[model samples]
Target: MQREPQVVEAKQQGGSKYRYRILAMLFVATTINYMDRSIIGVLGPTLIEHVFHWTKMEYAQINMVFKFAYALGMLGMGGVIDRFGTRIGYILAIGIWSVFGMLHALVQPAFGFIGFCMARAGLGFGEAGNFPAAVKTVAEWYPKKDRAFATGIFNAGSNIGAILAPLAIPLVVLPDGTNWQFAFLMTGAFSFIWVLVWIKIYKKPEEHPKVSQEELAYIQSDVEEGEIEQEKEKMSWAKVLPLKQTWAFAIGKITDAVWWFYLFWGSLFLHDQFGLDLHGLALPMIIVFLIADVGSIAGGYLPKIFLNRGASLNVARKLTLLICALFILPAMFVPYMSNQWYAVLLMAFAAGGHQAWSANLFTVASDTMPKKATASVVGIGGMIGALAGMLADFSLGSVLTASGKEGYVFAFAIAGSIYLVCLALIHLIIPKLERAKI
Candidate 1:
């Protein structure tokens, strides 16, 4: 039998706990990233009704600009991180996004909607770097067995960010939407603090003085699964883009549009259907994302349960994804509910399910691809997901303009059903989650 790594023993035995610090930083970064992007969403209804007075189509166009920029950023940022390493790559990303995020305050009414789109596009591009750097960081610091859980822990930050938006934004922006610009400025400023700490604290696991031999061994235990043949060489998209494994990962990400819808439009839905104002929207929105936070952590943990029970990695990952998809099926009924809280409950399940699904879906890349290529593959998948979001935004914008509240039925139905289809397609693309030859 293979010997267990000494780091698995109790910390009193001198096991180093430095990797958890890395995970914590990732969690904070993700939280700030989501907070920066989600500010617009939390302020959307107010902006549309009281401030910008934008039509549904115009609002959709603004979102489309962000998605388009995000899609392009994903394509490039993945390659940049893969080439430069996560440390510098992450700094560059956060720096760009923070500047643009704060610039939202500068968008004058004279510049009109075009100004907001410009700021959002910059924010989108910078925010695109987040997952690529984060996933690559996880792959560097944790073995495959722990990666999903680590991912889930950090991924939960998205929900926390979403939760914080309604709670905090209401405090910054008045009920009538005065001082709305402060919301973006305040949230965007957080990264400067994070960057200072990150610069001092971060280094490769092997190189970091705080990471002990036993802990380093623990981190490297599964390295052979995704062999690092050219550990120092940069991965080219030419190498990974052609693989079925890459497509499997990308296709699985098509459901990201659903998650984006929840983040960007869920509050609006609540406002329109249930007549909830900023404060009234808080409790339901908080309830929805808090449940999602649980799902994110649980989603990462569930596969470990299956793994311990003697299931194959392929089976554990796919089965967990299946459970998550089933949880989302109730979303179709969200638009039909007579009670607002009932609708909130159902929306919570769908949001939670998506977070769970996202946690596993992210691990699929590192599970199958080389560690060097993790960011690149994740970037490719994110780009595809962003493109999918753009398409959804276009459809939603046009439909809501023409049909008003009725558009939600179509939206919920798609969100409820697409997961199973994508899951089916993922299975068809990669029958087993074997490591890619690349």
Candidate 2:
């Protein structure tokens, strides 16, 4: 006998599996975000130092510009996202960053060093919206139990972008015998294409025409109806800043500089330490980020696994963080290692540990804060993290100029120890995983 129309609709609603499709979109946007951002670091040794005859300090100053603007942008864009909603905020962000990414090609010697600084600032400003939008989207689409895994899946795109840049840039610049301009232009174009797809397809679970009732129920399964309605109300920074949960998240993020150092300086470290040119840098870069990719996905999933096994969210999350922190301890010895590959191996674990740590750290924002306030909380934390990166860039630049290879020892030591300290602070501020009162 044929099923009734109501029964068929019910079955279809229950069977619908469309959230992954949106997660895939978030993953792609993150991939493009990192690709555009990392291109400068990948090409800095060849283009900035050798081709343009820029000094290390000058290069660092340029990075300072990017970090400074990124810090401010995080603060501003966080609010923008919370106010405007993800669909509009995300498109505007990618569009702005893509234009600035392409504008790198137009920066000429005649326009002077300040011209490049301007471009970097613009890029940083636009790219700031990425995480706020992504985390908000995750918070919107997935229930709490699945959030860490979902975040980990999309967060791995950073490693993918980091991975792709080394692979793709070699093809873009080397094949033409150093048309670095082509690289910026090529990577920048990706975001433009992504924006079109996002516009056509993205909508909230409740609002999307294609989302079935069963899927919507699954999405809302973990959230209380009271919280769901309240999440739509606006939350101001004044209201959010007072919460211990906010401080715990922000304090933990202060160590974010350690990861930023790995991205911005790892290539330079290889060039200076091992006498490896750009081509030789690719394999090690690939190794570091590939492991990071594994770490990102695994780190996010581990918490879910622990939750399934009956561990408390706090215990599972913090236990994973402790393990990640221990894994990074070997990085302190990277500058002292005799063999290049040994150093490479150690840095790989450290980079991987950071990615794992980051995936969980991002989830904390959504896990504790009200959905309406998630982006704002993330913005504040990101601003703190960006400030730490700014300090690293300036200090590391000076140390490198003054001490050459020996300077990296201090950086490595700091990177190795930062997480333990930050983790301790997090535990102190928020003894439990209770959600924020907001």
Candidate 3:
């Protein structure tokens, strides 16, 4: 009661320390969330040998089913997160996906292929909620200005999960080489640990007693002018959907799919090219992906460097993302490589570069949207991205596979170039990096 300004000042000085801890649980949740999804990619060859006797076309169809379901699911989940709060929506998402992840191992009948597809669909459906919920949570918990780095940290979870899979999936195998079941089960079960961590640790700014008033004030300081607008904007969905914020998110997400395409198909590309057996080429590629993990965290830190140089947030974010996107172009050379190690160097860095781009792109979505509607916008874009990814997958097996090795090189080139095209489209759609004028 002494003075309102003094209260805010005191809290700001102390409260900044707590933000990382608050975000740490979200980081782990994202890690486990993606870990569950990626297990299949790593276990693909084993699953074919042990479980379903899948033909190539049949396997493609199986993926198509999951993609279709996941696309629809993403559309629905984003809207739901808009209406509901982040915590509850996130819990529901993780709950269903994790359960199905384990169930992938339990299904029987060699011809019960549809059941496996359905389970994959369930995993896709559940995971659809991940980004929308996570983006929303970031929008809710962090001020607008700080979101990019935070988003980068959470998005890096994909890399972390992908990195771990080579070791984890192989470790749980049976001697006879039939035990892909334990890999799925163990990965799925890992999500529950994050659930416990998230439930205990997460809360809104005002709701957390440990969050001092000063800290909240500083957290809100850059965003103080919009706190009322951000809070008021949360009232409903219709008002939020009509603005440029919607497009900003959609474009960024569509671009995001390009990276996912690289990750989902990368090892397969190696296997296809090198006649990779699990122990040789695939292991090296996994090591490469694991090595790429550094780029995720590094991507976020780049803009902070710009900020120290006194660039505005808007300027710093765009410059950093554009630079990251540009790094992807060199990746087109992978298919041309006669040497496998050179191929590894090119592809891993390119994928890592994409993560760096991805880490900043999400910040752009938050940069352009008010907190209230961030989930819906992210959902729509992510939905489109996933759908586009499905098409890309089809193209990979069908079009890219046709030319043999050169086709593969061209495929990597196409993949590399997508981010810059995405960035150009982003510039056309909403040139300035600010919240939309709606």
Candidate 4:
């Protein structure tokens, strides 16, 4: 039998802070990922109304294509990352997505709808790799106690990306909406710069010369139960998919559809319901995502507090998720608010709560599975979440086509309440959050 590597005792002064440098890279990558994906959400009303002249159903179809590709990519990319490791996997994933993201500029009005779908499909397939890679990176670099906070820190990039889109896209998209291609082209360019930086900086903790022995020991200190040997063995979808912990993670991800709704449809909902123009949409969307950034970081911190106070891993994670669920309850009232900012505040809470919930939810997979299998589990859950979002897109398209603004009531209701149901199912499935045998 192979002997486990010995962990060096960390000094009282603390070890090198190299893990944070790795985390910063993850944060930037996720920020660019979200910005590229969010360009459409920020530009949705303009593209639908002025440029593409797409019907609501046609617009939904475009989003559905992205979600479909994302779902499939989650299945494949997770396995690919596990096979190849994060450095190469991340480069391939981002390169494909970035090139395809820039391709959105080439879409013209003749067969524009189909063109948009094709572009979105490529973009979605590439974007699907972001979370799997990021989560796996966190699992590799952080101890179990610190994983949620690190995940939250990086995941907040989604909100930063969301916030930046509204502020920046408007500057690039001409007031008449004629220069929308520049919006895609400019945002897509950011990833290439990020890729260059990432190539120079990233390496595994054990392999990187810059990582101190103490930091490496600190990182390896809290190996999960059964994970020592398991980490050396290869994992597959067949090995992971049968575990109840996998379902708990996947079931919890049903809320991902709610998040996608907020990402893809939130702008359109604001436009149709409140008569907001492109400039008008920026502030509310920015505020919503800003609050979400707060939630992501704070939510990740909550579980650490619980852990420090002597809570079990299961308790800390689940309780944080429960609080997040309650925060989303107010979102059901959003569509009924007479004041626009009132609706924005309510949606902000929902967005923030989801980000917080997401931070913990991502941690759960790492908590229960071996480091080797973390990306695969995240991918499986992401695929299921994307499938749920696709269904919501199809359903909401029909609802909006028939009922117009009133359809938002149904959509908000589902978004606000689904978290509780998902949490309940998660508890039933994996009450103890036991480590997987595989």
How do the predictions measure up, each by TM-score?
0.97, 0.95, 0.90, 0.97
**Candidate 4 backbone collisions, by pair:** none
Model 3 per-residue lDDT tens digits across residues 1-438: 133544656656655556778677667777777677777666555555556666544555666666777787777787777677777788888888889888887777554587888888898888888888887777766665467778878877777777677767666774234777777787655677767776776777667777777666656665646554555444344665667657665666665555655555666667677756445544665766665676777887789789868898777987887888888788877887878788888878887787788778777777777676677777777777777777766766565435544556556767778778777777777667766654
Q: Output the TM-score of candidate 2.
A: 0.95
Local distance difference test values of all predictions, in order: 0.90, 0.87, 0.71, 0.91
Better of 1 and 2 by lDDT: 1
Best by lDDT: 4
For residue 98, model 4's alpha carbon misses the true position, in angstroms, by: 0.4
CA deviation > 4 Å runs, candidate 4 = 1-12, 224-229
Off by over 4 Å in 1: 1-13, 225-229
Q: Between which residue pairs do clashes occur in model 1?
A: none
Best by TM-score: 1
The residue-by-residue lDDT of candidate 2 on 1-438, one tens digit each, is: 233434544665656778899999999999999989988888877865655666778888888899888889888889989988999999988998999989998877666378779999999999999999999999999888788899999999999999998888887687223687887887666787899899999988889888887777777776765887887788788999999999899988887898888888899898888977778888899899999999999999989888888999898889888988998888999999888899889999999999899989988888889899999999999989999998998999899889887889999999999999999999998878888886
Model 1 C-alpha lDDT per residue in residues 122-206, reported as the tens digit of each score: 9999999999999999999998888999999999999998888888999889867799889889865589999999999999988
lDDT of 4 by residue, 182-212 (tens): 8887755678887888889888888899988
Query: Model 3 lDDT vs. the true structure?
Result: 0.71
